[model samples]
Target: MSGDPLERIAAALERLAPGPAAAPDWDAASAFVWDAHPDALHPVPEVSRVPLGLLVGIDRQRDTLLANTRRFAEGLPANNALLWGARGMGKSSLVKAVHAELEATGLKLVELQREDIGTVGRLLALLRGAPHRFVLYCDDLSFSHDDAAYKSLKAVLDGGATGRPANVVFYATSNRRHLMPRDMIENERGSAINPAEAVEEKVSLSDRFGLWLGFHACDQDGYLAMIRGYCAAHGLDVDDAALRAEAIEWQATRGARSGRVAWQFFTDLAGRHGVRI
Candidate 1:
């Protein structure tokens, strides 16, 4: 018997439409990276993160984030958080570290890349009914001029119809406090028919995050503290005078002082001492 061509064509088209992703095996891994293509959560068996104590110079931020996360892990109310400020000041590091610190409480970390943000609604749907608590993290998140993705993000964060899942919290790190370039903000101000409205529309996205933690460029003392913390954590022993002198030289050559630089210097120091960190 000859089959109808249209029937076969319809079957092929149905196959082309993406199917619902498999329910994630939350117990398989402590961390995941959301994949939007086929709408799946890829397990991350090993998450690279520093010990919470090894993170120095941002003690105040550390305490605040830890408290918020702890409250959420315990099934209490907690607001979405935005970690904004200086580059390499440990904003992203803190998110991972805090997740690691709270892993014992069954908190899970899902790193959603900025590119996959458009799929946030789907991701939330996948996570909504799960027994686990999740931290949806995005690193170096920012919106450039002509980028419309932020609108979707703003909507999801604002908890439009579906609302954010009670078991899930969001934590994002951005170099820009407003998550937009200064030039972009200025351009909107210069060209918009309603200047104040235009500016507010772009800037208000950050308001969705109830908590804003600002990370600043570390001072010399803060940087030194980071270096020493790394040394102590890794069992690297060096004379204080020599270590400080070399650290100063490293900062001078790099023309910056931050936890990242201190860590880089520590790596070199460890290498020189024939120790692995």
Candidate 2:
């Protein structure tokens, strides 16, 4: 039988680019990111993270997260955590720090972007057979009213028969507690035939996460402490009195205090003082 001309062209393209089956070995990865285009996992050997000690004014949250992460790494029972609250309060930083701290103990961190939640199942599937423990880190993970991706996440998180691979834990940071805005849930309640049930269905997704760590805006004292901590860690030797004065002024100008704001102030301080931070 004669081969079709289209078939010959398709064969040529296949020879050039091939299918996902010809892709690199995913199991070789100590870490992975989910690629949704072809529903596959991309191998990543090294993760980008900040040191654990530099995250400040969150000792309670740090201790809780450290303990939970340690337990998971030790092969004990642990909860999937949701770190939520104020913007730039080190919610995402804490996640990366914890991952870095635990990596020496054989833990691996895989960062999945906010837009990749729907491909979570494919990522989970890829990790199920890997030897190292996995922390699925998603930063800034809130959803809008029209976004239906959370349903897919609900399935991957708890409903899959594979059921969140025993070697994996989820650590997500968000500006909202339930990963949805109050208005979204309120609108569902106002418009649905059965208000309570409709709200419950939309709200219950967060209930799947067993641990909730809330991050609030830092007080001036706490914020100053963080600035000093970063300054000290990075060897920026500004005098204590001047450091405090500048940190306070920086916060005042920003009209709010947070880890992010503190870091920004420190960066500017280091630049002006001709020191590294």
lDDT of each: 0.90, 0.82
| Candidate 1 residue lDDT tens string, 1-277 | 4689999889889999888777788899999999999899999999988999988888889999999999999999998999999988999999999999899999999999999888888888888878899999999999888888887786457546877888989999999899998999898899999989988977888988999999999899999999998988889889999999999999999999988898899989999999986
lDDT of 2 by residue, 12-118 (tens): 88887624423346456555676666666677775655578888888899999999999999999999999999998999889878877876787877778889888
lDDT at position 239, candidate 1: 95
Question: Ten residues in a row with the worst lDDT in model 2?
Answer: 18-27
Best by lDDT: 1
Q: Candidate 2, clashing residue pairs?
A: none
Provide backbone clash counts, one per model: 0, 0
Q: RMSDs, each prediction?
A: 2.0, 3.7
All candidates: TM-score = 0.94, 0.87
